[model samples]
Target: MSLENNKIFASVLTAGILLMASGFAAKSLYHPKDLEENAFKIEVSDSGVEVASAGAEEPSIEPISALLATADVAAGESGFKKCASCHTIESGGSNKVGPALWDIVGRGRAAVDGFSYSDALQGMSSEAWDYEALNEFLAKPKDYAPGTKMGFAGLKKVEDRANLIAYMRMQSDSPAALPQ
Candidate 1:
Protein backbone atom coordinates (compact mmCIF):
# COMPACT_ATOMS: atom_id res chain seq x y z
CA MET A 1 0.00 0.00 0.00
CA SER A 2 1.04 3.60 -0.55
CA LEU A 3 2.42 5.44 2.47
CA GLU A 4 -0.67 7.66 2.70
CA ASN A 5 -3.06 4.72 2.53
CA ASN A 6 -1.00 2.92 5.13
CA LYS A 7 -1.13 5.94 7.38
CA ILE A 8 -4.88 6.19 6.93
CA PHE A 9 -5.30 2.52 7.67
CA ALA A 10 -3.15 2.78 10.76
CA SER A 11 -5.09 5.78 11.97
CA VAL A 12 -8.42 4.01 11.57
CA LEU A 13 -7.13 0.92 13.33
CA THR A 14 -5.81 2.92 16.26
CA ALA A 15 -9.07 4.75 16.58
CA GLY A 16 -11.05 1.53 16.53
CA ILE A 17 -8.88 -0.04 19.22
CA LEU A 18 -9.07 3.00 21.46
CA LEU A 19 -12.83 3.24 21.13
CA MET A 20 -13.33 -0.46 21.70
CA ALA A 21 -11.05 -0.46 24.72
CA SER A 22 -12.90 2.47 26.23
CA GLY A 23 -15.95 0.18 26.54
CA PHE A 24 -18.26 2.62 24.86
CA ALA A 25 -20.86 0.84 22.78
CA ALA A 26 -20.37 1.19 19.03
CA LYS A 27 -23.83 2.74 18.65
CA SER A 28 -23.11 5.46 21.20
CA LEU A 29 -19.68 6.32 19.87
CA TYR A 30 -20.11 5.68 16.17
CA HIS A 31 -23.85 5.48 15.52
CA PRO A 32 -25.36 8.09 17.77
CA LYS A 33 -29.12 7.62 17.81
CA ASP A 34 -29.54 11.29 17.25
CA LEU A 35 -27.29 13.51 15.20
CA GLU A 36 -29.98 16.17 15.65
CA GLU A 37 -28.97 16.41 19.28
CA ASN A 38 -25.60 17.53 18.00
CA ALA A 39 -27.37 20.24 16.02
CA PHE A 40 -27.33 18.89 12.47
CA LYS A 41 -29.69 19.27 9.47
CA ILE A 42 -31.33 17.02 6.88
CA GLU A 43 -32.06 16.62 3.15
CA VAL A 44 -34.57 14.58 1.16
CA SER A 45 -34.87 13.00 -2.28
CA ASP A 46 -37.93 12.49 -4.42
CA SER A 47 -38.25 8.93 -3.25
CA GLY A 48 -38.11 10.19 0.35
CA VAL A 49 -34.73 8.68 0.93
CA GLU A 50 -32.63 10.92 3.14
CA VAL A 51 -29.96 12.92 1.32
CA ALA A 52 -27.49 15.51 2.51
CA SER A 53 -27.66 19.16 1.42
CA ALA A 54 -25.42 22.21 1.69
CA GLY A 55 -27.95 24.90 2.54
CA ALA A 56 -31.16 24.20 4.50
CA GLU A 57 -33.52 24.08 1.59
CA GLU A 58 -36.65 21.97 1.78
CA PRO A 59 -36.01 19.44 -0.93
CA SER A 60 -38.95 17.80 -2.61
CA ILE A 61 -39.50 14.38 -1.18
CA GLU A 62 -42.40 11.99 -1.12
CA PRO A 63 -44.49 11.94 2.01
CA ILE A 64 -42.71 10.11 4.75
CA SER A 65 -44.09 6.59 4.99
CA ALA A 66 -45.23 8.68 7.86
CA LEU A 67 -44.62 11.79 5.76
CA LEU A 68 -43.00 14.69 7.55
CA ALA A 69 -42.28 18.26 6.50
CA THR A 70 -38.73 18.59 7.77
CA ALA A 71 -38.58 22.33 8.44
CA ASP A 72 -41.25 22.50 11.11
CA VAL A 73 -42.02 21.11 14.54
CA ALA A 74 -44.54 18.45 13.56
CA ALA A 75 -42.22 17.16 10.92
CA GLY A 76 -39.27 17.55 13.24
CA GLU A 77 -41.10 15.43 15.76
CA SER A 78 -41.60 12.85 13.07
CA GLY A 79 -37.96 13.11 12.11
CA PHE A 80 -36.95 13.14 15.74
CA LYS A 81 -38.48 9.71 16.07
CA LYS A 82 -35.25 8.43 14.61
CA CYS A 83 -33.34 10.10 17.40
CA ALA A 84 -35.46 8.89 20.31
CA SER A 85 -32.96 6.15 21.01
CA CYS A 86 -30.31 8.49 22.38
CA HIS A 87 -32.19 11.60 23.45
CA THR A 88 -35.25 12.75 25.35
CA ILE A 89 -37.88 15.23 24.21
CA GLU A 90 -38.85 16.67 27.56
CA SER A 91 -37.50 20.12 28.42
CA GLY A 92 -35.31 20.47 31.53
CA GLY A 93 -35.57 16.71 31.79
CA SER A 94 -32.62 14.62 32.79
CA ASN A 95 -30.06 13.66 30.18
CA LYS A 96 -30.64 10.37 28.49
CA VAL A 97 -27.98 8.24 26.86
CA GLY A 98 -27.43 11.53 25.09
CA PRO A 99 -28.99 14.82 26.25
CA ALA A 100 -32.50 16.16 26.54
CA LEU A 101 -34.05 18.02 23.60
CA TRP A 102 -35.79 20.54 25.76
CA ASP A 103 -34.59 24.04 25.04
CA ILE A 104 -31.77 22.83 22.82
CA VAL A 105 -33.00 24.92 19.93
CA GLY A 106 -30.96 27.97 20.90
CA ARG A 107 -28.56 26.13 23.10
CA GLY A 108 -24.89 25.50 22.42
CA ARG A 109 -23.10 22.26 21.70
CA ALA A 110 -22.45 20.06 24.70
CA ALA A 111 -24.52 22.54 26.66
CA VAL A 112 -26.73 20.09 28.43
CA ASP A 113 -26.74 20.41 32.21
CA GLY A 114 -25.28 17.19 33.57
CA PHE A 115 -24.51 14.79 30.78
CA SER A 116 -20.90 13.82 30.30
CA TYR A 117 -19.68 15.29 27.02
CA SER A 118 -16.80 14.39 24.76
CA ASP A 119 -13.94 16.87 24.79
CA ALA A 120 -14.43 17.56 21.11
CA LEU A 121 -18.02 18.70 21.56
CA GLN A 122 -17.22 20.77 24.63
CA GLY A 123 -14.29 22.38 22.84
CA MET A 124 -16.73 24.16 20.60
CA SER A 125 -17.63 27.78 21.21
CA SER A 126 -20.73 28.34 23.30
CA GLU A 127 -23.57 29.07 20.90
CA ALA A 128 -27.17 28.10 20.36
CA TRP A 129 -28.92 26.06 17.68
CA ASP A 130 -29.93 27.98 14.57
CA TYR A 131 -30.60 27.31 10.92
CA GLU A 132 -27.17 27.40 9.30
CA ALA A 133 -25.17 25.80 12.06
CA LEU A 134 -27.71 23.02 12.47
CA ASN A 135 -27.65 22.52 8.72
CA GLU A 136 -23.91 21.99 8.63
CA PHE A 137 -23.96 19.66 11.58
CA LEU A 138 -26.88 17.67 10.19
CA ALA A 139 -25.23 17.39 6.80
CA LYS A 140 -22.32 15.67 8.47
CA PRO A 141 -22.39 15.18 12.23
CA LYS A 142 -18.69 14.43 12.75
CA ASP A 143 -17.61 16.98 10.16
CA TYR A 144 -19.66 19.85 11.61
CA ALA A 145 -18.41 19.42 15.15
CA PRO A 146 -15.33 17.32 15.13
CA GLY A 147 -15.00 14.94 18.09
CA THR A 148 -18.65 15.21 18.90
CA LYS A 149 -19.70 11.98 20.57
CA MET A 150 -22.70 11.69 18.24
CA GLY A 151 -22.48 9.10 15.49
CA PHE A 152 -25.56 9.45 13.31
CA ALA A 153 -25.21 10.04 9.56
CA GLY A 154 -27.86 12.81 9.89
CA LEU A 155 -31.28 13.59 8.56
CA LYS A 156 -31.58 13.68 4.79
CA LYS A 157 -34.93 15.32 4.35
CA VAL A 158 -34.96 19.10 4.18
CA GLU A 159 -38.62 19.26 5.02
CA ASP A 160 -38.04 16.81 7.80
CA ARG A 161 -35.26 18.98 9.14
CA ALA A 162 -37.41 22.06 8.98
CA ASN A 163 -40.21 20.27 10.71
CA LEU A 164 -37.88 18.88 13.31
CA ILE A 165 -36.37 22.28 13.90
CA ALA A 166 -39.79 23.69 14.33
CA TYR A 167 -40.54 21.08 16.96
CA MET A 168 -37.26 21.74 18.70
CA ARG A 169 -37.98 25.45 18.67
CA MET A 170 -41.24 24.85 20.47
CA GLN A 171 -39.37 22.88 23.09
CA SER A 172 -37.37 25.99 24.00
CA ASP A 173 -38.23 29.56 24.92
CA SER A 174 -36.57 31.22 21.99
CA PRO A 175 -38.58 31.48 18.78
CA ALA A 176 -35.55 32.03 16.59
CA ALA A 177 -32.96 29.28 16.41
CA LEU A 178 -29.40 29.99 17.58
CA PRO A 179 -26.05 28.65 16.41
CA GLN A 180 -23.18 27.20 18.34
Candidate 2:
Protein backbone atom coordinates (compact mmCIF):
# COMPACT_ATOMS: atom_id res chain seq x y z
CA MET A 1 0.00 0.00 0.00
CA SER A 2 2.81 2.45 0.84
CA LEU A 3 4.60 1.51 -2.39
CA GLU A 4 1.39 2.20 -4.38
CA ASN A 5 0.92 5.65 -2.64
CA ASN A 6 4.56 6.52 -3.39
CA LYS A 7 3.98 5.75 -7.09
CA ILE A 8 0.86 8.00 -7.22
CA PHE A 9 2.71 10.91 -5.61
CA ALA A 10 5.67 10.49 -7.99
CA SER A 11 3.27 10.51 -10.99
CA VAL A 12 1.53 13.69 -9.81
CA LEU A 13 4.88 15.44 -9.26
CA THR A 14 6.10 14.41 -12.72
CA ALA A 15 2.87 15.68 -14.35
CA GLY A 16 3.14 19.06 -12.64
CA ILE A 17 6.80 19.40 -13.71
CA LEU A 18 5.87 18.53 -17.31
CA LEU A 19 3.03 21.05 -17.32
CA MET A 20 5.30 23.84 -16.06
CA ALA A 21 8.02 22.93 -18.58
CA SER A 22 5.44 22.96 -21.41
CA GLY A 23 4.24 26.43 -20.41
CA PHE A 24 7.82 27.76 -20.49
CA ALA A 25 8.45 26.09 -23.84
CA ALA A 26 5.25 27.55 -25.33
CA LYS A 27 6.09 31.07 -24.13
CA SER A 28 9.63 30.89 -25.58
CA LEU A 29 8.25 29.66 -28.91
CA TYR A 30 5.65 32.49 -29.09
CA HIS A 31 7.21 35.94 -28.67
CA PRO A 32 4.59 38.74 -28.76
CA LYS A 33 5.76 42.06 -30.23
CA ASP A 34 4.92 45.23 -28.32
CA LEU A 35 2.54 47.60 -30.13
CA GLU A 36 4.17 50.87 -31.21
CA GLU A 37 0.98 52.81 -30.41
CA ASN A 38 -2.19 51.85 -28.59
CA ALA A 39 -5.17 51.27 -30.86
CA PHE A 40 -7.18 53.34 -28.39
CA LYS A 41 -5.56 55.54 -25.77
CA ILE A 42 -7.33 56.85 -22.70
CA GLU A 43 -6.03 59.38 -20.20
CA VAL A 44 -7.00 59.89 -16.58
CA SER A 45 -7.65 63.44 -15.39
CA ASP A 46 -6.77 64.84 -11.99
CA SER A 47 -10.39 64.20 -10.99
CA GLY A 48 -9.91 60.52 -11.99
CA VAL A 49 -12.24 60.82 -14.96
CA GLU A 50 -11.15 58.81 -18.00
CA VAL A 51 -10.78 61.15 -20.99
CA ALA A 52 -10.23 60.19 -24.59
CA SER A 53 -6.81 61.04 -25.98
CA ALA A 54 -6.74 64.46 -27.66
CA GLY A 55 -5.87 62.87 -31.01
CA ALA A 56 -9.01 60.72 -30.97
CA GLU A 57 -11.57 62.19 -33.35
CA GLU A 58 -15.09 62.24 -31.97
CA PRO A 59 -17.73 61.17 -34.49
CA SER A 60 -19.42 64.18 -36.11
CA ILE A 61 -22.89 64.69 -34.67
CA GLU A 62 -25.58 65.77 -37.10
CA PRO A 63 -27.52 68.90 -36.15
CA ILE A 64 -30.78 68.14 -34.32
CA SER A 65 -32.58 70.82 -36.40
CA ALA A 66 -32.16 68.74 -39.54
CA LEU A 67 -33.24 65.55 -37.80
CA LEU A 68 -36.28 67.06 -36.00
CA ALA A 69 -38.07 67.82 -39.28
CA THR A 70 -38.76 64.16 -40.01
CA ALA A 71 -38.22 62.80 -36.50
CA ASP A 72 -40.80 60.24 -35.36
CA VAL A 73 -42.66 61.66 -32.38
CA ALA A 74 -44.04 58.22 -31.57
CA ALA A 75 -40.56 56.79 -31.51
CA GLY A 76 -39.47 59.74 -29.41
CA GLU A 77 -42.28 58.99 -27.00
CA SER A 78 -41.06 55.43 -26.83
CA GLY A 79 -37.59 56.72 -26.06
CA PHE A 80 -39.02 58.93 -23.34
CA LYS A 81 -39.75 55.70 -21.47
CA LYS A 82 -36.11 55.79 -20.45
CA CYS A 83 -36.63 59.19 -18.82
CA ALA A 84 -40.01 58.30 -17.30
CA SER A 85 -38.29 56.86 -14.25
CA CYS A 86 -36.95 60.30 -13.37
CA HIS A 87 -39.44 62.69 -14.96
CA THR A 88 -43.11 63.20 -15.70
CA ILE A 89 -44.17 64.62 -19.07
CA GLU A 90 -47.84 65.22 -18.31
CA SER A 91 -48.88 68.81 -17.74
CA GLY A 92 -48.83 69.71 -14.00
CA GLY A 93 -47.08 66.40 -13.31
CA SER A 94 -45.17 66.42 -10.07
CA ASN A 95 -41.37 66.15 -9.95
CA LYS A 96 -39.78 62.74 -9.49
CA VAL A 97 -36.06 61.93 -9.21
CA GLY A 98 -35.74 64.57 -11.89
CA PRO A 99 -38.02 67.58 -12.16
CA ALA A 100 -41.15 67.32 -14.23
CA LEU A 101 -40.16 67.66 -17.90
CA TRP A 102 -43.46 69.25 -18.92
CA ASP A 103 -42.81 71.88 -21.60
CA ILE A 104 -39.07 71.36 -21.05
CA VAL A 105 -38.34 72.41 -24.62
CA GLY A 106 -37.33 76.09 -24.68
CA ARG A 107 -37.78 76.26 -20.91
CA GLY A 108 -35.08 78.03 -18.93
CA ARG A 109 -32.46 75.82 -17.35
CA ALA A 110 -33.23 74.85 -13.74
CA ALA A 111 -36.70 76.37 -14.25
CA VAL A 112 -38.62 73.61 -12.49
CA ASP A 113 -39.96 74.80 -9.17
CA GLY A 114 -39.23 73.04 -5.84
CA PHE A 115 -36.56 70.72 -7.28
CA SER A 116 -32.96 71.14 -6.18
CA TYR A 117 -30.75 71.56 -9.25
CA SER A 118 -27.01 71.14 -9.19
CA ASP A 119 -24.84 74.26 -9.21
CA ALA A 120 -23.67 73.30 -12.72
CA LEU A 121 -27.22 73.52 -14.13
CA GLN A 122 -28.09 76.56 -12.00
CA GLY A 123 -25.15 78.40 -13.55
CA MET A 124 -26.71 77.85 -16.98
CA SER A 125 -29.92 79.60 -15.91
CA SER A 126 -29.38 82.22 -18.60
CA GLU A 127 -29.68 79.61 -21.35
CA ALA A 128 -32.97 78.09 -22.41
CA TRP A 129 -33.19 74.41 -23.36
CA ASP A 130 -33.10 75.05 -27.09
CA TYR A 131 -33.07 72.14 -29.54
CA GLU A 132 -29.35 72.47 -30.23
CA ALA A 133 -28.49 72.79 -26.57
CA LEU A 134 -30.74 69.83 -25.84
CA ASN A 135 -29.02 67.90 -28.62
CA GLU A 136 -25.58 68.43 -27.09
CA PHE A 137 -26.83 67.83 -23.59
CA LEU A 138 -28.56 64.59 -24.54
CA ALA A 139 -25.45 63.40 -26.32
CA LYS A 140 -23.52 63.38 -23.03
CA PRO A 141 -24.91 65.01 -19.87
CA LYS A 142 -21.55 64.97 -18.06
CA ASP A 143 -19.73 66.48 -21.04
CA TYR A 144 -22.44 69.11 -21.53
CA ALA A 145 -22.40 70.15 -17.89
CA PRO A 146 -19.65 68.80 -15.70
CA GLY A 147 -20.61 68.30 -12.05
CA THR A 148 -24.25 67.92 -13.09
CA LYS A 149 -26.24 65.62 -10.83
CA MET A 150 -27.88 63.94 -13.83
CA GLY A 151 -26.50 60.41 -14.03
CA PHE A 152 -27.81 59.52 -17.47
CA ALA A 153 -24.93 58.59 -19.77
CA GLY A 154 -26.89 60.12 -22.68
CA LEU A 155 -28.18 58.86 -26.02
CA LYS A 156 -25.34 58.26 -28.45
CA LYS A 157 -27.51 58.29 -31.56
CA VAL A 158 -28.37 61.76 -32.89
CA GLU A 159 -31.61 60.38 -34.31
CA ASP A 160 -32.69 59.13 -30.88
CA ARG A 161 -31.96 62.53 -29.37
CA ALA A 162 -33.94 64.23 -32.16
CA ASN A 163 -36.90 61.91 -31.67
CA LEU A 164 -36.90 62.44 -27.89
CA ILE A 165 -36.73 66.21 -28.39
CA ALA A 166 -39.60 66.11 -30.86
CA TYR A 167 -41.66 64.17 -28.34
CA MET A 168 -40.69 66.70 -25.66
CA ARG A 169 -41.83 69.53 -27.95
CA MET A 170 -45.26 67.89 -28.23
CA GLN A 171 -45.57 67.72 -24.43
CA SER A 172 -46.03 71.49 -24.33
CA ASP A 173 -49.42 73.18 -24.85
CA SER A 174 -47.84 75.15 -27.71
CA PRO A 175 -44.98 73.20 -29.18
CA ALA A 176 -42.01 75.28 -30.20
CA ALA A 177 -41.68 75.81 -33.96
CA LEU A 178 -39.22 73.50 -35.62
CA PRO A 179 -35.99 75.14 -36.76
CA GLN A 180 -35.68 75.93 -40.47
Best candidate according to TM-score: 2
Question: Where is model 2 poorest over a 10-residue stretch in terms of lDDT?
Answer: 53-62
* TM-score, prediction 2: 0.70
Q: Estimate each model's TM-score.
A: 0.55, 0.70
lDDT of 2 by residue, 40-89 (tens): 87778898988777799877656889889999999999999999999999
Superposed model 1: Cα runs more than 4 Å off: 1-70, 177-180
Off by over 4 Å in 2: 1-60
lDDT value, candidate 2, whole model = 0.94
Best-fitting candidate, measured by lDDT? 2
Residue-level lDDT of model 1, residues 1-180, one tens digit each, is 899999999999999999787776655578536554546556678978897556878643333223222345555677878888888877567777888878765578777778888887777747666565665566668767777888888777656655676676677665652332
